[model samples]
Target: MSGDAAGGLESHDYDVVVIGAGGSGLRAAIAAHEAGARVAVVCKSLLGKAHTVMAEGGIAAAMGNRWKEDNWEVHFRDTMRGGKMLNHWRMAQLHAQEAPDRVLELETWGALFDRTEDGLISQRDFGGHKYARLAHVGDRTGLEMIRTLQQRTVALGIDVFMECTVTDLLKDTGAAEDRVAGAFAYWRESGRFVVFRAPSIVLATGGIGKSFKVTSNSWEYTGDGHALALRAGASLLNMEFVQFHPTGMVWPPSVKGLLVTESVRGDGGILKNADGKRFMFDYIPEFFKAETADSVEEADRWYDDKINNRRPPELLPRDEVARAINSEIKAGRGSPHGGIFLDIASRRSPEFIKRRLPSMYHQFKELADVDITAEPMEIGPTCHYVMGGVEVDPDTEQSGVTGLYAVGECSGGMHGSNRLGGNSLSDLLVFGRRAGEAAAAYAEGTARSRPTVAEADVAVAQERALAPFSGGEKASENPYTIQSELQQTMNDLVGIIRTAAELEESLVEIEAYQERARHLIVEGHRQYNPGWHLALDLANMLLVSECIAKAALARQESRGGHTRDDFPGPDPTWGAKNLVLSLDATGTGVNLKEQPLPVMPDELKEYFA
Candidate 1:
């Protein structure tokens, strides 16, 4: 298998292949290795440079270090409320219960989080939580977490294949069980094809935010994991719910879509309109009425005394805040840069600002040339995370396809309709470990002998991957043009606010892009060619875009990240179901199915009551 002369592909064998090197992938590889399975991690970029490094906010866990009253039950309740009760209860419960240990485990692996006065890990405030719960390190928590996990993986002697992109998941069709047989990938530097023959494949490739025009996500997130799962006969859940973070830098055109971490508002930043009014107070929804401050006095005072007073309206859940910001900008009350003003300069001391958000301070001072210590920063919504991906078993993290697993932002059901601010980090840790352990066990228990890879599948995969270089008549289509059009279409039509008409129009546009993607042209050879890479990425983006538009059109109600202007409220019937997307048996089209929500156990129901 090492020398496949027919396809000119190099082959390697491992018990488990983890197709990502971000937080989840590294953690999964480490766990699989510990479970006695030979493991390898394949990533498209250099280790430690995955998009996880861009995360600023801390991980959320009920460590009970900052607040004695905080516990997993409270965290679970907040998560459910944040997701508007659309979350898979078991996944949410597992995340909440296991997040603390995961955080502590990171610390043991040399992640130095900010320490409290009591010498414990420090916790900070964030939106959609009952108490201060984010374990941070000067707003660069992800960098520290990724570094620590990478170091741990190295120490555990796990194999890592950097700069590799997995194009397809190979499976055994002749066998009784259609389990994963291997994966086909190409080296980014050399453009040579390679295959990994493994009994289990774990897809930790992150979100699909790159499909939108204004996104905080990096280029690595092109729905690769989502598309791979779909084409591999797996289901995707809740694709309609895409989270738009409320605060992204709207000034300095070059950094227009860059993220402004929620830690700003968490640390007492206020949102104001051009009229100098705290506009968030007027935009508080009834859903948060019981917990939010209705007036400026209470809100300002609550910052000093969070125990007795309600939280500020500026600290509302991301979906609500993003919608309010969108409304403000549209109503001619926005800042000069077409966004709202976030003022932390007047709210906190300059020293505290620099200490707590060093990266944010540098980001503004260097990029926008505005000293955030003296002036407000203009910000708006940016596509940050997707609360949807491959559908999986809550406990095992295995998808519908046998021996295929997904974790991190690529897996669905943990965050439900909208993800909370700090939940993404913890979600990766808890579920990544779960996926690794489960995949290792499955591989060891079932894979008694080496699985066979079909030569026909390899031929088809190679043909599909190299079609862009064929220079056929249809190859005149430019990949960049189609990608840009698709981004703008998703951004405008299926963005923060949606209607049936716009979504239908988006579907039509997506179809056009899909057709263009088939004939995409790459001018240069494959070696380090970005055009060739994006040509491949466009297919995943278009497929995921179709799923989002179709699901958004079908769900005629507002819930969490998915807002329908035509149907302004959540429908009980829609709330009880999850929109599941899968590939049609023909493998040419997508099939949408509605799966009923799982019933919550009587014991867990008491928490909500």
Candidate 2:
């Protein structure tokens, strides 16, 4: 890999540099600045609109004020169970324990969560959660969280590099070329290039949501962090289990994969058949049958819990719920559009619905021309969070590569297979801070490391940016067309479920995409060239998808977020193998290896169990 940053129209340096100013990135920058490092937050969008703003549910944490039964141990167990036991025990433990402190810290920094009458932060029930432990604002919880972090970071005087995209990592070396020096990025507004020379770098660059055709992810969620890390020579773990959310609005092609917030369901909404009957009862898994309420009578009883009964059945885990909806539609009991109906009208009064779910009402009426309060909303699974990422020590958030760090959705082993609804927000706070602290500490004494950018690396990045404009490769297909084709292939094949036959085909298709990318053409100059940026992103997403599909094929036994019909049960022998994959300096190909699991101590075991 070339170590130099290309298109160096402008150049700068810093003590620490952070890519992507989303929730985790903002928080990391704050911590690094606090640690006395000169920090800069380079982002793709305007400060507030990074993917974090679209997070609709609440932040998961165990404050333990309302429910005495609630604590980090219970939260950890629920996370492991929700992830189907594939989550790293240590990561889950630390995240659960530290989440409450982080949420309270947000409050101290001016986040205003909804409050109970007694005035503690309010919590809500969400899929895969064992308690009403998600601390939230009305529905725009992620927006509130990121806004608060953005404010705090700005107040700290950390440098903000808005509308800039990092194209490569610049490594400095003392003949050996093994350590980090800084990075290269380009300005989006003026078409100017900049090289940020720093001993420390933090990547919190969100997900590969755009990799799927129909997704809740914005254009910014192109797995930038995932791609950046791979190029810098770090191994990504468990890329197989990408989470497909159960309730993306399925009508109006423009909004096809946009998310329908879970808050609707949390506020007494129900999933129904075309005949309007609730169907979750028939689909509860064995592990959760004890906590699941089976009948309408039990469901009605839980509304007040006056004559006391189990919690409602409507709150089942997301995977089981999505599968149930899929079955209902397959049995010809679906709405006209082939999706189950999500209705809140029957359960709550119009006044209650209007007040509690204003955003849902607004979004459906504005975007879909359907008033959610009066009409049944059309819903189906769509691509959402990625479960696999660069493997790190669950607590430290450090990658295998020296001086490299990952946080938020980009780091692996946190959610295991499927992440619970509210857990992501809390996990971001927990690990983002950990990664920032660790990176800052590493940068303190080791500021000038061995690896610095070599001229060859700069040329690789410059040519990489110029490839589409060169217009010499696949002249027949447009870059956007290839991108759309790639997303469809992944969605149809490596989506919610998987098989070895389909995975092998996906591999072939991905290879073809790599070849086609070489010939992609662009119509405009470097200034705001969406096509060029996408062509660049395709390389990353394709690599990420390869890791996911290949690893899915390797793990013959089903566990957590991975469900293979051919290999339907978790094999004890495969107990704790972490599949780690990385690319060489040339980005020619990849090598995957297995690393042993960190042993769980008694303290971790008690909490993990």
Candidate 3:
């Protein structure tokens, strides 16, 4: 609501504009402000209530606080291998090299991490880590991370527009190659429109998980950034790699898909079938077999003696564990609630469980009426994260479009095909700072020739955003119904395990949903209307769903988060390539093209060799 009138529309100008208030967005804003740039952060939720607070595991970093052998090189190797070697080598390298420094930087900015016996920042075990490498604050690491970052942002005096939703990216038509000039947004409270005019825009808007029916994502994660980037002529990479987390609550209907943090498994939890057998050992892939324990005895011994024994199969990458759980459910070995059992009760004492994973313990006790200290929790795969997002530069996080940047869960290539648990927080810090610094530099360079927001473009965006309100009361199409159908379509056909037939059928259903969405009608006034807001968000979800489905079908190989039932194994040919999604010429459909993966230097390739 704070802006000056520009051509009769409310407009605010800044050097850099960040489109989220999560961990990445806050870090970016702080970085830009420190670099002497006037920055503005716009978010769809309150300051401390972003989906980032929902991250319960620790920040992955090679601090080596607990393990002497841990370092950046090992972290790099683990990331590349965990991602199935499809990662952009430079991004993975940079992330690993910088993560420790970023974590320590958070402490300097007043983050209070759990301490080791020697008084160093404590590091804990997580899936895909070669050592205990997660810097944590018990199980509420993300909550503490957000608290620290929010304080840093406030201390820097960066402007924040809370409860604001961006509907479109405004491009400057005057430039020979169109560049992002600003953004079109609306206040979630009053439904009043506002425009942010900036030379550089950083999209830290997270992922597309909410498009699926059962997901760990909050309602605000409707793929707004992905759709905005596509419409602004930026391409998304690896849209097929949608990560369904292995442990989402599945017992009670209401809390189904709520996340069960990886901390549970990291702190000695194990997965079991209905017959009370440890099942993850049977699902370890050939690639991971060399480093994974083949028997229960060694896996258990690993907890106390890390130097000699291989890690547990329960600590495999998310995609592997999720697929294993899905297979167990389908094979009739699942719990009564149609999921596998995640038990930490028998392995660890009640006091240890509460001290290590207080959040997970309470989440189950309050929501599902299950006690983690005594019984197993019924859990299954739920759409958690999308490794696909705006394709950005490895060093600066800038997209192909000038003056536009993306970071965190809204950017691709850093995680490649699968993200290791705890790595997400570190990715946000590393890339968020790079993007903010780069955006500030770009904004300064363009000060003399800043792109102008065309009044005409703003008018078009406003019309599209307000269209749902004008539909008659008797209109047959309902926004909520269309959204529900779309979610079910994605969950049923394009979920954890997919087939060519189901993928094709999903595309057809998506098209029908699109038609229904076009005629969407909401029965409410513009002010504080949830239905109208959903109507606007539906467009983003539908567009992103098409990208996911099309990319999944075209990939034609099983790898990482994307598993094709017909093509059950990873194909060498597809492993060396990436699929990029862009808007078609008409800007009404998506087009996909195969691009060669970035070649790793011989020095770095030695890790895989």
Candidate 4:
């Protein structure tokens, strides 16, 4: 924890530095420490309060605790199909094969998941899974997972720098090649600049949901990892694929984008429009027709007699359900609030509802004044996650840049265009460990070729971070105002449904925001100043938003999370190629190109046949 102060910047050295404290980052830190590497974790929040705690669903795994027939092969097939077969096959296969072990490992570390009648870990049903495969603890699974990981982290004596935000990643441009050197950051409490010098850096900084007005993500998710990777010479994959979760609170104004966990629907909840018709049945796509129930009787029977009938249409992949909700609202059948009704009270008993979804029961009662035991909840599609992120090697979780790695939501290609409901937690555990181990190995192997953090680079980062305070209060543009406008632009144009005209318009608006952001003015000083922090975050948000808009405009077809109204059907040609975005040589604008998807092995392809 020792550091030298030079040019007003505090510098600390470590073998591996993880730039997030969520599930993936903490797990990576633990693994790096276990591998005998000096590790440090930097996070924007307290130790146990990263945005991972907001995940209410359980970890997806094929432990077969609830259903004997469930296995890794089945989980693999489900994940591939859920992502519309556009997923990086190797990543999906590894995630499915490794998820069960990861979940059990969490239990060994004292995760306390709910149990079945026979005392094995309980598994619940979620959208796009073939069986009840989500290992959970009521609805607080994320909170429990964080608690377990954080406790293990402290016990292992892992160093955690809480309330720290990294603004840029420094690169070592040697005579032979360029490599990652360190990270430039600042403390949120005191607002003092700090630099972490590490040969290996893992970015687990999560998603880009905050760029949208209505999102389930916290303010910390302003696309920091995505932007950092791009600027540090890594490419982002499938940037057009932004996931809008089917259920987010749409009422009471204050909590409009708060998430309503999918665990409710998993435990017998149904979605209905104002006409009291279960609208999901009408919206089931041709892709899932073979497995989804067509009638209410069969749908209900499938819950009790899984072997005899198809699963309910309400349990379709998230992309399909979200689109259906959007269509329902566009029509005149929406609820009083601009959403559809999710009814669990009528299907399950009060005690059962509370036992299975305790968070939903309390969230509604406290935030919206609606009790799940009494009435249906009003929910709609809200910006939830970005399936797109820094492209990384599926085996090692290392990005294209040497000495840099990414995992969880910050790294792309695991979930393709749409992620299954419970897969995020398991993905974090599986790839988090892989990235940590790989980062440590990279650090150990690169001692001689280790990159150095130059004093000149540190000076430039400091100047760029302090640009917002240059012209004082009369700088014309306010950071908050610019951020609000950017959110509105993304939400209105590049949302669940898109068209060429709107997508083009959004790029124009984003360009305007990027220009305005350069002249942003913050009122307060550096110490504990939220406006100043947001001023810095706006740069990342603007860059990532442009990538999303550019990719959305380039891909002219409908598939999974990315849908275009002008080109309403999924094109086979477009489906086979992924749009890769990278910062051009000038480092100002992003360049877009296509890369063919990795061909799946013949044996694995037989699953679809």
- Number of the top lDDT candidate: 4
As a whole number from 0 to 100, the lDDT of residue 522 in candidate 4 is 72
The 10 consecutive residues of candidate 4 with the worst lDDT sum are 1-10
lDDT, model 4: 0.92
User: In model 1, which range of ten residues has the least summed lDDT?
Assistant: 1-10
Who is ahead in TM-score, 1 or 2?
A: 1
The global Cα lDDT (0 to 1) of model 2 is 0.80
Off by over 4 Å in 4: 1-7, 307-309, 472-474
Q: Identify the runs in model 2 with alpha carbons over 4 angstroms from their true place.
A: 1-8, 175-177, 306-309, 447-451, 473-476, 584-586, 607-609
Candidate 2 colliding pairs, count: 17
| Candidate 3, run of 10 with poorest lDDT | 1-10
Q: Model 2: per-residue lDDT, tens digit, 293-396?
A: 87878876665551332556667777667667877887999888768889887788878877766777888899889977677898987888888887776666
Model 4 lDDT per residue over 211-271, tens place = 9999999989999999999999999999899999999999998999899999999999999
- List per-prediction Cα lDDT, in the order shown: 0.91, 0.80, 0.92, 0.92
The estimated TM-scores of all candidates read 0.98, 0.95, 0.98, 0.98
Model 3, TM vs. native: 0.98
Could you tell me which residue pairs clash in candidate 1? none
How well does model 1 score by local distance difference test? 0.91
What lDDT tens digits, residue by residue, belong to model 3 across residues 18-131?
Answer: 999999999999999989999999999999988888788899999889988889999999999889989999999999999999999999999998899999999999999989
Stronger candidate by lDDT (2 vs 3): 3
